[model samples]
Target: MNQNVRNHRFRKGIAGLGALATAAAGLFVGTAGATADTTEPVDPQLAVYVEVNSNDLANVADYTLAESGEAAIDMAMIFAANINYDGEKAYLHFNERVTETLENAQTQIRPVQAKGTKVLLSVLGNHQGAGFANFSSFEEADAFAAQLEDAVDTYGLDGIDFDDEWTEYGANGTPQPNAQSFGWLATALRDRLGPDKIISLYAIGPTYTTTDFSLFDAAGVLDYAWNPYYPTYDAPTVPGLDDRGRLGAAAIDLSNTSAATAADFAERTVADGYGVYVAYNLTATDQSAYLSGITEALKGESTVYRAAPGDTTPPTVTIKSGAKYTKGDAEDGYKRISFGLHDEGQIDRLYVNGVLKDLTDDRWSDLNFVKSGAFGAVKGENTLQVLDVAGNTTEVSFVLTK
Candidate 1:
């Protein structure tokens, strides 16, 4: 959830939004990639959230690890998609930009991920009666979890991050916040996503106070819990999460949080032995100094800004002839083709015959693939579609003869 919006609304007398504005957002405003200089030490656990509602998601990849350049943050979270109730039922709502980004994950999202960043979709509330911590039953939680799982799989995401806020309890006969609801939902998400996917929490709202910590299996079900309030240091009491799993330092809002304060937070996070540092709301402008404050304090390295303008061009896929058939036999008439995938961002998915045949977690930039066998091509006219992370695609049709 965006603290700026929450702070603005709360100042206008909207209660139940949880806490006052952060010191940074209330008083000030300010300004990804994992490109790091390997020569120096690195703190690869820094995390950030980008508000897709206002800023372009590509900005997250602009931060290089160091002077080496072209690196991405360890994790990049999409600010949010909401769980809103429609008077009949609660459903996931991805605003226009969020929907566009996810729908075209190959172009907008994959390129960032290609730079070695883990992309996560954050789920929050929309001032509706429904929320993560108000599921009426375990089954209800499971239903929501299924929606999240489908979204993660559909977009090829790394995981889901839960932020329980802006929910008007019992607004439309929806169940009120309960101790078990948050835990149930988290557990359900864990069950659906299996043991490998990340399930993190922004430690605020119902998740901050609820007694569901006992139910969280930090080693398995939960990855890390971050303090949501900015420029304030507070450690959440989630069970099973040790120093590595607890991010207690102040969470900085890049626009408002001062570089000194951000550096102090990073220093505290490092000195206190916390494994993760949190920063949010990165814009298109260069924020390398603010980032350098954190990186320097946390890992004794400087932050580098590569300064690439936003990408709007679509990716291209071209077929290459005269390729050796490495995997299949010519006797069976099953031959493979080689193709070049090029993009300003990164290539993410390939579809043949309207079916998804190949995908990657870390998207690619200018690559060649030679299918060993006749995976999608048949002995007739075949269609191929390639997509970039920003949802751009290049599709073509070619005839295959035996």
Candidate 2:
């Protein structure tokens, strides 16, 4: 079937999930006392999509072997896809023929699903682009979607993401039917898969002056349309604009926004009648902050909280003594300390003596501290405190000499 015609017919048969109504209701409750000129604030939901290249998994596993296999899975939930496609084929292709990659991803992704995290399968829309591009017609797109649907069914993928950035390379300097074609494609997919699945698009935030929201409006077919906020690509560096303006600008320029951008996007998505998710390339030092922003945006407060005073839950810490240590003797000369913490709200700050350590550093996974400190151990008992995200102090304790 011709892709466009099929998409049109499919869209005609399905209806959106009524996300706008939910958005409207949320807006009414959130903006009860607003003035006529004051537009309802946008409250976007925040999520991160990790672009996992199958080619890169071995490297990732190698780098994270010192930690745990689950680390890769944890990283998977932060972003949308394990494979990046550039519209080249109807299905995922790997440089290595080993099927273990798929099996490992499925195993790793399950924990994320258990945590109720949303997963998206990303595909590039441009035929001439990188990753998986160069399809000649809409039938190819349909065939690809079918293969993708099978993968989704097998691995429990949450949805599909369409990213088409090749309009700039076309003649006449216009994207011509690209957005329309994508809209139709999304509609058809919605019809075939039903409303429970999410269909998202990645568009140039600023450059694309016209958008056919009708496709999204039809069956609420499009769940999320992600406009990247990379500093170099979409967002502007200027200040003083409302959060939405900042985000919109960021979408256009691909610039990085402040931590507040999370809150801003959450607000905007809620206001604009769309589900929202943010995209950030991960780094070791910024993980905590990124998670902090996401937690606040999603749940309206930081999940990391300080235990109130008088709270009696003793903070527990588990230490892993490396293999280099002698049995029955304290491993005193170790270069790092590895531990897991379950803070039931009484710990304040984790400290090595009196010095503070950053838990967001890349070396953190290696050091094994939950939050703060790079590398250093004081002789005798080491004090560990449970604290809230607000910095309120709660309980303190000492770890015995190893």
Candidate 3:
């Protein structure tokens, strides 16, 4: 899943949508092409990269969410959803409102760059509708290459992430129409971006069957691949493209109990030699707790932060200010309750009832994190708990009134 895809709620035709996204939502067709491959590999970068939604920059606008705008991270993929390919050119099409939102994201991302991360725009071709894979011939690939270069230069971006999935085929046994073109496109992008820029793809080792890995894995074509929520059965495969061929581990369930799960995956991949370790979409108040496991395996650091010492104080928890649930206050019987969970040390877990919930949209350093989202409250009681990494805890209970 391209986890950070925009909410494509624009009710316009592809033509109009294409026009709006680049020239304001009207579809424009483009040209394509093809290529062969190479096997030599480059060194893999052992660094941490994250995907933050450009559609909702506010969710990650805060410094706490900012992480290190620089060296603390390796790269941050600013996700731009639905960059449609028209057999002639590739275009990013979003409604006007979304366009403004992304512009804000572009500005907001500067802080992340300040801390040392290379922020790149990741354009994904939508799976359900017309996409890169939907183009009729190989020549359209060239069309996309030109347009993509324009976007990179226009936005002053560091690089691009090609996120394409296989949903274009009409039948089970049929061959993909743009497969060869896309391979050429990948090579074209590598050449256009030059040697230093970062280029990655969205695919796992074993699960992605439709894509011909060999085509895109040429020595200089790809830099990384995001194969999230890795399952044990698939095992690890050597990657294409030289330098830092890391596998991404999604943190949808990276928690206390699952730390070992992530650690094991990181260890084995590193042991295999060419692979690097990485984590995705993590928002814990204590981001270290989640990333520490992966880092331990990658660098063999003797001290795991989960076991490290500092502040031993219990965390403080409270319902965020301005929350309301009076008559007609909430939407569809679900009230949005925001929480402020903080600790002198690392805040580990924030749970509503017994199920743990992430209390912050952004990752907190060693003190605070904000968590907000809709809550399903019946006509009665609710409970919340916030725990520090050191095992100290805090709790809050309240009643909803209509």
Top candidate when judged by TM-score against the true structure:
1
Predicted structure with the largest lDDT when compared to the true one:
1
Predicted candidate 2 versus true structure: per-residue lDDT over 1-402, tens digit per residue:
113211211221121222234336442111221222215544444444442332222222211111121222122222222223343333453323223434676555554555445556554333223222223345654665566677667766677765444323333232234334444455557766788876655543211223344434432565544443242112211111113311321221102455566446544444433334454433222244434454454345543222123344444555556543212223443333455545445334455555565453221222253222333445445554434333544333334343
Q: What is the lDDT of candidate 2?
A: 0.39
Candidate 1, which ten residues in sequence have the lowest lDDT sum? Answer: 27-36
TM-score of each: 0.66, 0.45, 0.51
The residue-by-residue lDDT of candidate 3 on 303-335, one tens digit each, is 222222344677775544443422222333223
Alpha-carbon shift of residue 325 in model 2 (angstroms): 42
Better of 1 and 3 by TM-score: 1
What digit string (tens of lDDT, one per residue) describes model 1 on residues 1-402? 455333532221322133434223341111111111133332437888888877777777778767445453678888788898988667888988788778878777888888878899988777778988777788888888899999999999999988877877788888777888878888889999988788888876665565366666655678877767665555554655544434444577778777888888888766555657777777888888779888877766788887555557777765554445232333443245566677768777777776675566334433243343355566656777888776777887655544
Model 3: CA > 4 A from native:
1-70, 85-90, 94-102, 105-107, 166-175, 204-217, 229-257, 299-402
Q: lDDT value for candidate 3?
A: 0.46
Off by over 4 Å in 2: 1-43, 53-101, 125-140, 166-180, 205-219, 232-277, 284-286, 303-402
